[model samples]
Target: MAVIIKPFSLTVEDYLKQEEKAIDKSEWIQGKIIKMAGASANHNRLTLNLSRLLPLERGEQNYEIFVSDMRLWIEESQSYVYPDVMVIQGEPEFTDSQQMAVTNPCFIAEILSPSTAGFDKSQKFTLYRSIPQLQEYLLIDQKSYRVELYRKVGERQWLFTEFIGKDAIVELEIVNIQIAFSELYKRVKF
Candidate 1:
């Protein structure tokens, strides 16, 4: 499918207003609004697997995990983001108009897409790190059976780890849980 490239000019407020009326998923980044591309079978599988696993595992009182659709807000950068899977802990400060967007999320996951892999790894990672409360960021590869995890270390540094194969287990330090790689790809076809 040919991507419909919309010129970047809308202010953050305008982008939010326009997004409310949009029929499909889109994200506003640095004044440029980009439409979300359709997900691949592997991407869909990974998203569904995380959505099911996180909520059941994350303690009810501490966090709420959501699939795609919920927005993540970065106030300093004046940008809004929609993550593949996000886990938010604590009482979030929300805007009356942006009740759907989350101000703070402890963990955020993004499954790679061909059209978005570069941005997700570089730009989006940089932007997500700015979130003061974000403790972990996950990037799952659709083509390869790998998951790259970044855990926050201090005010400005983060630690990285990668998991692959059925023997591997993914760790979420923020919530104190371990998820087996095999469990995540249980029903996923290679």
Candidate 2:
């Protein structure tokens, strides 16, 4: 996350065009473009841990891994977000010719931070559900070894599961992958 602000609202097209040229990253929520918050060292470590291990669990041939640099656009919510970790089962649906913004993500993970935890759990999760291809959302806690997984079971229905402690295993049923809790929190100071 980076700190860059715009005083006005930007349309989807406008956001995409400007975001490409911008030095740092920002998100488009509804019609407003907001600056992204900075991530702590622990947050960065957790994101890297998962990003590095997911390819092995999900298979490099089947899933493509993306960290926060790539943008995910939810058409229904009219949002553009940079998730901590994202896995696409197959080809991604790009929002524009530039291929800078993605539309379809089978799984997404966000690192929890004091400044953004509430938004990630409530408002951001609400918007992410709008994507038909999204099957699971992982919220990884940077303060402790905890993960909250929300698996989509049916239309408008989601099942909640939690994994806590270092030895716990986080199961991603949608992708048939499992990750040890300790691996995700590796090198995290908190």
Candidate 3:
């Protein structure tokens, strides 16, 4: 038989118990907690633009929309993430505490950068896949007007679609919502 090493598992509760102090920023991937990188002005604007549209399209509904600063907990993989933009429907699942963590999200969007693109597309996307409630995952390019959408078709499969050009629009089938290209790249200087 081949040698097999069981993967370590870390729960949201145990992860929080490790550190009571808060750093500038951090992310939990698998069982490893990593620091978050600072965003550029363009990145910040794109993230803001995306966050602004969610609630408007969703209305005063039960969904929650969060920007870069918020943390999201993935229950399955036992990881916590801070996506550039996050939207969750239904009631707030997690309780309010000093070390609170988000358990589920219906949608998540990340603005791509050269540094984080690989992680976002491969590593981060792999982690995001573990979230059972994640319906759609979006990757927005700041250098150009390109939006890539991954809509879930089944429990473990995601359908990929890409939108290009400034006039293009991206639609999320999961949430039954559409957003303009201009809205995503608003105030974003090339």
Candidate 4:
């Protein structure tokens, strides 16, 4: 005889209720809530650097910047994710009538950690592409100054670019700002 066990499931409403009180962040997918690991020192530094480097120019045709704490809803997957950094142009669309989760992000940047790099590059990136208004995606290395940018050019086409070394600079086209790798890696010990 073989023994088997079933995974636990939760409705989106229940997941949100739990998430509101949870100390740490969790990703809700399908029907299960996956708890994310605490960010490393390097990861934390990079995330902060990335956010700080983003230009705060807001008036007309500007973007709203959000840190990782904000929850993002992927309508296609019915999953909620927290990107390291997010940029929303104009107004952001919320998930529920209560306006709990964001459904639109013009640009998203994810700081790569050893544990989540593979998932961020594959599943998470694919999930983010489902957003019709997403124009750019960035994968930034936490331990080093490597960055990969994907810019959406056509309806279904995307252009890829990579920048490396401390002297490199990534041009945030959506916001018309450039971020230097040196600045982005500041205070990052690794």
122: Cα error in model 4, Å:
0.2
Off by over 4 Å in 1: 1-5, 56-61
Q: Please say which candidate is ahead in lDDT: 1 or 3.
A: 1
Per-residue lDDT of candidate 3, residues 1-190 (tens digit) = 0111234545556656653476545666677656665788888899888887776344455677777777787766667777888787876467356536576788989989887887888977888888778889999998899888998898788899989999998887656667898787889999
- lDDT (Cα, tens digit) per residue for candidate 4, span 42-78: 8888888888887666555866789888899999899
TM-score of each: 0.90, 0.91, 0.84, 0.90
Better of 1 and 4 by lDDT: 4
Q: Tell me the lDDT of model 2 at 33.
A: 81
lDDT of 1 by residue, 1-190 (tens): 1123478678888988888798887788777777776777788899998877774444556667778888887887778778899887766566565477887888999988777778888988999999899999999877767999999999889999998876788988877778888878877777
CA lDDT, every prediction?
0.80, 0.84, 0.76, 0.84
Model 3: CA > 4 A from native: 1-20, 56-61, 95-99
lDDT of 2 by residue, 61-120 (tens): 477788999989888887888998889887877877878778888899999887788888
Ten-residue segment with the worst summed lDDT in candidate 3?
1-10
Return the TM-score for candidate 1, rounded to 2 decimals: 0.90
What is the clash tally of candidate 1? Answer: 0
The total number of steric clashes, by the backbone 3 Å criterion, in model 4 comes to: 0
lDDT of 1 at 46: 91
Ten residues in sequence with the least summed lDDT for candidate 2: 55-64
